[model samples]
Target chain A: MTKFNFELTKEIELLRLVTVGSVDDGKSTLIGRLLVDTKGAFEDQLMAVRKKKGTVKVSSAAEIDLAMLTDGLSAEREQGITIDVAYRYFATPKRKFIMADCPGHEQYTRNMVTGSSTANAAIILIDARHGVLAQTKRHTHILGLLGIPHLIVAVNKMDLVDHDQATYEKIREEMKEYCAKQGVRDLICIPMSALTGDMVSVRGDNMDWYKGDTLLETLESMSVLDDLDEKPFRMPVQLLNRPQTADLPDYRGFMGTIASGTVKVGDELVVKPSGKISTVKEIVTFDGNLQEAFAPQSITIILNDEIDISRGDMLMHVGQEDSDSKFLTANVCWIGDEPLETRKKYLIKHAASEVKAMVSEVNFKTDIHTLAQDEADELAMNEIGRVTFKLQQPLNYDKYADNRTTGSFIVIDSFTNNTVGAGMIV
Target chain B: MSEHKLTQLKALEAESIHIIREVVAEFRNPVMLYSVGKDSSVLVHLARKAFYPAPFPFSLLHVDTGYKFKEMYDFRDAFCEEIGADLIVRKNEDAINKGMNPKEFGVARCCQALKTTGLLDALEEGGYDAAFGGARRDEEHSRAKERVFSMRDEFGQWDPKNQRPELWNIYNGRIHDGESVRVFPISNWTEMDIWSYIREEKIEIVPLYFAKERPMIERGNMLIPYYEENKDQLLEGEVPKMIMSRFRTLGCSPCTGAVRSDATNMDEIVIEAAAARRSERETRIIDHGSNSMEDKKKEGYF
Candidate 1:
């Protein structure tokens, strides 16, 4: 057995992204091609796919059936479509990538929501000949609703359109107008053929009219390392640690993952939903005590005063407005097959807090294809609608558009406990 | 020892810790299925970090297949004592007394009884609503799209297709009376990630991973550990001998095979794994036939 050099050739920041597009738009093909071009797949992995039993290879040459590289399950292979959100990982010299490959079937749109929810950016693919379809609009709207910081429109299959610049430009203009209306601030449009391997990893000299960065370049250079530390401090306490002993009986600390901003030893703190005030005395990890902590860092913090805090309680800076509300309106994507109805009590899990909330009114549902709002009594599976909630207890949360951490929630069925719907505070 | 900016490693660690904490906070009764392997070691380490200066809210449960290496048991017992963790060892004493061994009962049936049923029996007694396992996606074909919060039915069955959509960091740990959810905090971590993390954290692992001279017998191309219990159960032409080998994955002793390597330390093992082309599961003897991990997991085998 030859020793494979598993060394990191270069230091690369990991970027998590999701690609959403309609069926046959070459999303999986492009992802496979990226791994192949970047040497992400091991030789054994490639060979295993090539020698897969009962699976046909699309190309005769040294090419692989790219779709087979990702649709791993036997059921998915038999059905010829992706069922769940399959996460694929690869790294380039510029950066490492965690790509969530979502299925494009309309019924599987719940999966798209699951995939795109935590993505730092998204690549919405488009068929060059088909132009801007309704599914494209639906995906674009979902990405915006997820508050994904960046967006890339990969206009795939230019080879089918004879690599024409006019068609690419037309789609670009249409997408720009549509995205502006959808509130996508950072958008990049790239036209390439995932099948021909042109401009995916290697910048093939095709369609010279497009002088912008390739999809790979755009993703690598995209500003995903946002200065979250500068934002107001917010950490939802998930666990409370108390080493209750004879010597250290009062040693109590609030443990949580810092969702945003930074904290120092002397900074004042505010426990949400209670407005109890305290000051940071120490930040603790298993390593040792710390003087300061920042977003995404898991730490146990000891405050100057003992505030009545428990699991699902959020701690934040006292003055961070736009991070609190009880009666809130939100855009909900009904993921469960069971239709959502007004006056239905569901468990709304927002950040670390879970509260029993009921939908007071089902405002209206959107026709994703026509971008029209229609009056509806309830939201079914894969349907998006606006609704108002009446919470049993007052909960402090940031708007979904402002802070992705506190602004989003999932509606769990009280009777079944299945996550029935995804909500983004409007 | 100090707060730092978000590196990729720190981010992954925080995410895993967050998941572990959520399970402990949300579930009515949660138990961690400790396998005493590298990934499980990382999970325990994360749990310790998640609740520092305080005792763990949950207990560690081990499903004893009665076929594991002697060194694995030693490591588990000592580690539990060292950490002062409440450890529960659930064994299928009925199946063992009924003469259910891999040599006689065959591989699949033996595993189903000893491993899957062992876990089921433990869960039944504990009434745990959630169980944490150190399963990773990069380890197998079926785990490519597995959710971090994987749901199990009343019969402890996993429906790969019909799973709840886990969005954001909010996990729906809410389950019915008999249903449970298997939480994989380190689901996204690859084998490479596991080894790298172990090296970074200086976590303790079992000595079975390091190659050493041990009594062994080759059966079905697997280097089985030649124990006193299996002295008379050798196949027709198979004889026990001392062989220098190591296990890539630790399972029931009869089912898991040893790989010929000289990685006596974490550094050497990391280098070998990186260069060894074949995935780690290649060393798993039980995974050879129709008994895949996915199917075993559906039957409640961690």
Candidate 2:
């Protein structure tokens, strides 16, 4: 193979965003519009869709099946609804985007959690005509609980209201008030007719009274790197690459992806739970050596001296000690066929650490429509609640709001081996 | 490194390494499934780095489907020799000689008997408690909800809806006897991310990935190659054409297809792959027919 000198000139800024809304709120159409208006659609694909027979010609507006743009599955096309998360990719000169269009139905709440898990920003669509509905509040509340820093409430179907600003503001104010009550600080509201090209990418003159930036502009201007700087150094060991061959018999390295912060060669480090101290010897990638590594980067590390280190061990800055505690308060989204029962033993996975845990108590369950917390004994599907868990072994963690990488966990049912709930440490 | 605010690739790599280590620490007997593909190459590369200063901890298990490109074997052998790791090759010759043609028994059944069954036999014989694969979520819709530590029953069935919720980076690879977990260190990586990582890391892959001169036949818009005995399977319209082509994704020969391209190097291939109209799996003849991929996945085909 020829030696290729690959230089990354432009920093690849890929944003994962999910479009969420209530049923019949045109969330899919809004995404389809964003893709279409930006010229993200392929010529052959558009032409082929137009040629399809017996296609629904809704509103007689060019007869374009907007849902066809995103609903890629045959079943989804036949049913006219998103059954699963449909990921679509498009790139502008500024940045690349991977949009996850999640289902709007209430039963597919688990699908929504799957879609928005990795999203940096969420586009919660609300039909202007209907204002904020039950599903709308559920999605927004989910986004806020998921720790999505930025949100764009795309009040779609402005054409239905003759592009009325009053309807947009009424919904926007209601949404803003609801989000504030739910502790969502950063929110942007935009009125858009996803059917027609209005304030999606290009500025639509119909909404001249609106002073804020367009949807695309708002997304572009949003800070790509938020408070990731505040997160402490954390690298979860995934594998131990100990080549036992005759040529390099003494090779011992800790391989894993860095969850947050940075680690350099010769930096003092500490392994979690076991609390073993070590110094960074070398940082290795597939190509060659690396000087340092940070969050999201997968790399192998060789320590100066061999320490008893294995997988599920976390490597962090040595000076900063992590607390090994057995109990934590967390906000959980129950997603099991069986409702969460108190005192049930479940396996808890926090970062690279796994421990046996049981729900000690149910604090309160949040009302999906009202965002109100009511004391409850159990949680069902699509329900959000605060719960306390007692762990069999001490887990090293930070607050979920502080460091998302180390502060989240999943509750796995011991009997059926199903993931019952996802929790963010409070 | 100081100038760049850790790209998503870096984060993914770190996380994968972490997962790999965790699997090794938690599981008693673990083996990596090497398919001689880009994703597996990344997996091996990460494995080498995960336990640097020492040899790779686990052995590599390759389940030969009996209809692979000859070059893939050569590449696999060469890589094993370079890394000085043990390579375990298993094949279903009994089923093959029994005259089980994939075209007759259906793609899903063929995959189950040839790939999944063969893999199960090898795992049972080798007593492997866990197996690491290079499967990624971005590859398909069904894969999107897959957990990093995906547990399988004694029969190796993947219960999609019943998977453990994987939040943050915590992975639960726990399973009782007769059950094992399929660990994916790079579950979040997309096709673009894999290519970029391959380029950035300068990981060596099969030469078939780059465009080259080869005898190929056009079958339903896909470039099918005429290799060995399979040459006679071509119909009248399928004429051999010497086109510059490369396989975007690798699979069994009969199932995988090559795309016509001039991208002889990584840089050109990345651009072309990024702009490709169809998905990587769209060209696979086996998946093109009926609900084969999903069906095969349900029956424990990796």
Candidate 3:
């Protein structure tokens, strides 16, 4: 190892990804391999894993069980399963990565959703011996519904099947067919063995028939920047800043993150639900006033005119205002252990706005195994279903496919105050 | 990277700022827990940026164990004064009066009384509904699974198995009267990110992070810095030595170990950290035991 070229390293971008797999699919092993190969895992972490005194013994050809690296909880280690989503960080010369290691059990689908929600790409692991299992279909369906643009089907454990290219191709084709059905825009299939150190970071000789980029190369070369700035500008007001001080006694700036698109100093802006229009006087930051700002940048916006705006009011480009609706149809992923009861009041938190809401109807639950919509009265844990929500107050939102920031919301249990469900507008 | 896109550091900054502002908007009473370490320094810097024209909306709370490095205290007071921040210092007076020392009660119990119980008491006394902690997910295994908006029960205990499902950036900040939330603004940030951000932003951290010739004594294979309170802790044959070293982390002087290094400047520190093979918490003796942090967190420790 040498001193990092700080100049070149600082310019590299970040890539957020999630790993999807069922139990025994070597998901954690794959992540551990990436971290170790990239020097992301520290010596201490590896030492801890090697010396871990757990009762359950993981079967692996490697000296240490890579799966133990991610199964952090005592219960998980004891049970030899991942219970929740765990985030791991690694960096290559090309890009920095935040990989969400999602749990792979059938019942932990909600945990997978939680991890997959923010990912720009997903790595769906399939054991070569078991082709595309029902668990794989379930994971693929959930990832697609979460709007993950890129999907990499990693045909793991090729060594288990004697490094057979036919086996790899079979799983690849099955995954491709399934992903296409789910409308996955970008898909790549790779053959590798996490245990043998093959095709994960480096190209090993085992998969000579494979001609695609290694898993690392695909992640590094993949385009993470989207057309978010090209969309209509939206900034959800998170806080109304009022600094009543001697220098600036009457300063009132709306503080928020740019949800989508770009805004300049003189750009015209409108507050949603209020229909009041104003111009951006200044895009303020601690460093200085930025002349222009785009999506995901947190800044304070001062309007040229004094408008009545408070927290939860969204600033948007005029004529691109979202629809104001009190009733909405959405695809909901039930996360709470307690089943969702229809007509019971819950809280809907949408883009800085929290309002009382209730499930008006459960249209149908998606049978993940077959990807079929089944009629349902209520949703149980890990069940994905279409539901109608009646809100106490109207929300300004867009279709989830068009704009993820404005279109998504979480269902919070009013009594428990726990985030019970995650919903995306249809 | 595209010209229009923000750099990784800038994106991280924006995300942290967004989290800070969101907590301020949602929580009625929120306080930033400042420990005067490098992470806390970055956090304070972000909070300033979150509410630039106005001072940060909330006061900073420091749970003083009364056994921290004197230099940390000096830097904390000076930094707060420089930023014009409203700083609140809390201590477990009952435990201190009972003379609960690490040497007598052990590190875990001592930490429980001084840091954990002190923090819970302060939150209750201040009526804080939310607290911003500078915990990064990459620091520890258990924290890697922690939510950005972590909910705490009435007893301040963390339920690892029953955490709320945190999806995307839509954090649920709602809680009952006795419950509170621990918001980690930089949950996605890694140790390298923290040091890189510090170098890029020129953030002021305690001088202890930079290598200097300091008096120390070796205990349990760790270079423990000598403080006035640690004089009685010295063994019969052991003696303090002046060594060229710096801390990878800062906690209680007796528990935090210093590594032999000549990296006195920010650039050297960053380069050294990048090349170092060990984890950041390796130097902290309190974290030596497996699942110790998990156990502590379950008992209301941050």
* Tens-place lDDT digits, model 3, residues B1-302: 26569889999999999999889888899999999999999999999999987889899999999889999999999999999999999999999999988788888888989999999999999999999999999998889989999989999989887778888889888888899999999999989889989999999999999999998997765898876566887888889999999998999876788998899998899899888888889998788654388888888888
Better of 2 and 3 by lDDT: 3
At residue A331, what lDDT does model 3 achieve? 90
lDDT of 2: 0.78
TM-score for candidate 1 = 0.91
Task: Give lDDT tens digits, candidate 2, residues A158-221.
Answer: 9889889899999989988999997887899999888786888777678898888889888777
Cand. 3 Cα-lDDT: 0.88
Show model 3 residue runs off by greater than 4 Å. Answer: A1-4, A51-62, B219-221, B227-229
RMSD values for the candidates in order, in angstroms, are: 3.5, 4.4, 2.7
TM-score of chain B of each: 0.93, 0.95, 0.97
- Predicted complex 3: CAPRI docking category: medium
Off by over 4 Å in 1: A1-11, A51-63, A204-214, A321-323, A370-377, B1-4, B212-245
Residue B172, model 3: lDDT of 86
Per-residue CA lDDT of candidate 3, range A1-426, in tens? Answer: 365688996678899899998788888789888888888877767766774456234233264667666667775677777888899999987889999999888777777888899999999999888889888888888888889989999999988999999998888887877777768899999999997789998899887888999999999999887888999898999889888899998899999998899999998888988889999999999999999999889999999999899888999988888889889889988888799878878889999999989889998999876678898889998788999999898999988998899889999888877788989999
What is the iRMSD in Å for candidate 3? 1.4
Please give each candidate's TM-score: 0.91, 0.86, 0.96
Q: What is the lDDT of residue B199 in candidate 2?
A: 80
lDDT of 1 by residue, A227-322 (tens): 677788889898787778887699998889998888999888888777889999999889899888888888999998866999888888778744
